[model samples]
Target: MWEMAPPKGSRLFQTLGRRPVLRAGYAVVIGVLVLSVVEAYRIQVSLSGQHEEIYRRYVDEEEHINTLRRNLWQAGNFVRDFFIRSTPEQAQTLRSQLQTLQAEDADVLQHLAQMSPPSPVPPGVVKSLREFWAVLDPVPITMLHASNEEQYDFIQREIVPRRGELYAAMLDLSDADKQRLRDYDRQFAESNGRAAERLLAMLGLGVLLSLVVAAFSLRHAETLEQQADRHYAEVEEAKRELQQLSGRLLEIEEEGRRRLSRELHDEIGQTLALLQIQISNALAALQGQPSGPREQLERARSLAERTVQTIRNISVLLRPALLDDLGLVPALQFQLEDFQRRSGIACEFVEESVADYLPDPVKTCIYRVVQEALHNCEKHSGSSNVRVTVRQRPGSLEAEVADNGCGFQLNAKGMPDQSRGLGLLGIRERVALAGGSLEIDSSPGRGTRIALRLPLEAQPQPAPRVAAEVPA
Candidate 1:
């Protein structure tokens, strides 16, 4: 049920304890996660700022270049109209429009120059616009003084060629800026990909470290659990052995008591009786004679009789003969009467159909249970009344001894406390050995009840020794 542990002098890890390893693992994982998040956020912010700036620059460049194209085209159309009609009003209008367009182009170029990096306008695009405007500056004035044919010749040679160049330049500038924006987006995408790869690598490293720490910790925990299980098994084995030894000791004790009771009853009782008889004979022999020592003989005989009675009582207390001769019920009745007589506590004994053929062990167990319970009542229960009941069913026998006393509390397991549990434990052991069950119930102020049940089936018993009866 367990994995083999490392050999002695071998550690689960080469360096650092499990706790430190686990802490380091956690720290690494968290640090990696935090850094990854920060990097992602930084990347996002960079992309947003860069995208906004790029888009703004692209839009502005397109707008200015488009404006340049529009103005240049309009100027070309005005020059065509002047060549066709040769009108002073048209020429003046064309000059004023040209100046306004040039001024607008200049302002746009200045604004583009002031924009942030990656110059939106190519270097030569601005220069070409300025030179084209310079060449067209005198075209309107020339148209007013020149003949129609000459004007047409000048318009075609100067205005038409410069206008085409400037328009083409504007188109080229738009295309260039679009290319720059595409390049910037590609570069940003590559940077984001590289950052993601690095973050993933860090996370993978952290996960691997965490798994190592977890494995170490789990192995250590399993080791401790195995050790605990071994210890528990040893304790349980010791307890079982102790219980068997205790049961053996109790049987030996009972046998000793029985033997001693017999010896005292047979030997000492005979001796005292002989002494009493001798005194009676002596007194009879001295009858009718004064100063015959008859009074002393009577006193001696009285003392001898009392001594015999005392020895008989002691014998009964050690091992009651009624238990062997009259069966379990009579023995229990006598015990209860004796208890009441001695303790001055009221005791009631109730019995129903208890058989004469009960197994000796069961009888002993039941009697001992009652004996122990009554002892507790006298010593600890502080009670005024006690009750004992024994009943026989088809297959079992049940008994109870209860007291209306200031009962004591039970332990967490609802068993007697250790300090007071010796007698109760002994009773339980006996009952268990007899294949029976016992229940103890009590509370602080209510009362105490000890109930027992024994199976009627014959249980295995040790062989009994043959013994002689006590002399009457």
Candidate 2:
């Protein structure tokens, strides 16, 4: 026989990768359903056990109460027969047996009280017991002092009748107790049955809800899986486009830098040099001439030297030569030293295994970030001391720059002109490009601390060498 095929466009046709979140949600819902089922089963078992206990107690109490009533009736019959006997000795023997029977009845009543039955014995039962006790107590004393047949006749006529009445009342009391026990048992059964029914209903509802939730979760998972596939495809495409755009942007930036560097070097550099040469020539020509001419040439030479120096500073600010020639640490050291000297701020530098661990691009990013931070500190913070630290750990690199300066409120927004507060933004972007995070902590009148953490690529380990056999 041929195997049946699944319907078209069914869930089975979809791949597992299509909906991870929905699958997770469905798993959670199924777990909750299983727990509910287990809990319901437990409650059902517990109620069943309770029902058995209540049933047993009801039966036992009913039997005990009935037996007590029958015994009391028998004691009444014995007393009546003794009173009707012609011999005093026979009466004495019956009275002793009757006393024993009465003690047994009292014990039973006490036991009943101890049981603390759910329902109390009826008021009629209590009244009957009191009457029986009154009759019995008086008869034991009166029988001992009784003289002859007259006393015996008195016992038969008066005490016997009262004893019969007391016995009947005790029987009625026992019957009332039995009725109460039966009623209590019925109520208990009804209450237990109702509780079980409610529990079952709750369990059924819980199961139904679970099933509904499971179904919804399954359907939702399928939809989410489809959405995830679309999102993944979009993300991959975006990533590729972003990579291409970044490369193009880097190329454009490099070209622009080269053009600017060339212009500064060829135009401004040559002009300044020419101006210096011309001034020197004029100075040489004015030797031993008028004081004014000599002074003018000297002043011109001085101005030309200052112009040359200013141009060099601007070029370095645009792009540092050391950064291009050397590595990041060396470049940062040079920049920090220059800042310290110019600003007359005491700045210390510290490093830990960072020189060999960081990639060149990451190093450049971190260096630039630190450079901007320091510049901001010098311009804004009235700080006297600064400390820069660089360290490397197992998975990342870290750098911090702290300043003992009059810090400003860091939570404040940018200045009115957007151009006035791009320093921190630039630092943040540089760190982000290097796959790092930046945090700034500062308070008014306190110092400012800037921290950077960058993720590092895992270094490949060397292959193990095979051991060579030694000559034996």
Candidate 3:
């Protein structure tokens, strides 16, 4: 508030000091505001004290009354049980209970003398408790010799009447508590009406000061908000740029794999086939001569065939040609089959007749997502069975890979552990590049399910299209 005032040497402050009319007006206004605040504080303190005192007294009275009622009811229960038992053995416990209850009841009535404005319960209620206990203290011994008919007669005559009187006293105290609350409410309303009237007049002057203050505050706030918005937009642009770069990096990596797969199949693969043919020819030509040379040639041919198969496996793992040659379904089937063979886990693939006109990027994203999901299941999930399902939606394609395995806990970042995070991150980047979404569901022993959804163009898209990238 002091900061809002003009400095001593400012032009406005100097002008006000020189002008008598302005100086006088400002002084009067300041003095009036100070007086109004002092008056409001005084009234507020008075109302608070009144509410506090009434509340304290009411609570103390109710606490003392409730304690009395409970003790009295309990003492009556002890005496009734004395009359209930047919054998004298059970009566011993009842005698001890009544003695204990009498001590507690005396302590309850003692609090009434401590109350500031005496308890709401009449003093007669306390006297009634003492007299009722005086009558019950000896009744346990008398009950041992009495018949069941005589016990019922004593309970009807003595126990029920005194317990009812104590209950009635409590009901009166409850009524007093309600009445005290009603009085406080009425007084609060009357005081509040007067305070509101006084505050309304003071608030009229305060509003004028607030308007001047707000003009300065709003201008300052607007300047800060403009700076914030500019910084926010800059940060958002940086993230978007980073995402696009990541997507491009994934695309480059995939292109490299495709090139490498093709080279292995075309160059090294053909060379190996030719080498096998030469070894087989040598074996056939030397068949009638030495058995040692022919056997060595036959072994060389066998080694060549196995090496060729190993290279093919490596090429497929790097980037399956079926993804580009056929479509998504065939590539996934082959991947699942390879997983089942490599790891002894069972694999099931279910597919709907998906449109073949889908873009290559979409197909690649779905295939890689399934491939990563299966790999995680094999490496981490001790799963017996794994299932993969791909179906087409109206404007999208959905693929799900699930396993019944000992799953995993997602960490604080909603990711599987750090190692799995690295694998999922690549799939997320690829899916983002193809306008798709990936969802992973996994927890302790329940198993994991990875669901992938990709948007589709209405018509067949012959040329693959790259999507706007987003972060995982």
Scored by lDDT, the top model is: 1
What number of backbone clashes does candidate 2 have, counting pairs of residues 3 or more apart or in separate chains?
2
How accurate locally is residue 463 in candidate 3, as Cα lDDT from 0 to 100? 48
- What lDDT would candidate 1 get against the real structure? 0.80
Model 1: residues with Cα > 4 Å off, grouped in runs: 1-57, 63-104, 110-116, 139-157, 285-306, 344-346, 379-385, 404-412, 415-435, 443-446, 459-472
- Which candidate do you rate higher for TM-score, 1 or 2? 1
Model 1: which residue pairs collide?
none
User: Quick one: RMSD of model 3?
Assistant: 26.5
What's the number of clashes in each of the models? 0, 2, 0
lDDT agreement of model 2 with the native: 0.69
Regions of model 3 farther than 4 Å from truth:
1-213, 411-414, 417-419, 461-472
Cα-based lDDT at residue 229, candidate 3 = 97
Q: Estimate each model's TM-score.
A: 0.77, 0.44, 0.54
Residues forming the 10-long window of minimal summed lDDT in candidate 3: 463-472
lDDT string for model 3 (1-472, tens) is 3657655434543565434534454565676678688878987898888888878877777776777788777877776666666456667787788778877767766776666665555778777877788878878677789888888888888878988987897888789787988888798889888887887778777667555445545644675699899999999999889888887887888899999999998899889999999998888788689788888888899999999998898899888888888777778878988888989898887776576556777887888888888888888889999988887777899999899999888877557777657888777777777878888888999998888899987865434332221111
Residues 201-251 of candidate 1 have per-residue lDDT tens digits of 877877787776677668768867998999999998998888788878878
Instruction: Give the per-residue lDDT of model 2 (tens digit) for 1-472.
Output: 9988644324432544324644655566576657667766776776677667666666666666666666666766665565555356866676677677778767766766778544355666666666665665555446655556755686576656655665575556556656766786787678667767766776676677667556656766777898999999999899867766764574466456645755676699789999899989888888888899888888888988988888777766766656666655567778888897799898888766654434656776777788888898989888988888877677887989999998756545422124545788767756665668888887778988889999988864323223221110
Full-model lDDT for every candidate? 0.80, 0.69, 0.78
Clashing pairs in 2: 18-225, 19-225
Of the two candidates 1 and 3, the one with more favorable lDDT, higher being better, is 1
Compared to the true structure, candidate 3 yields what TM-score?
0.54
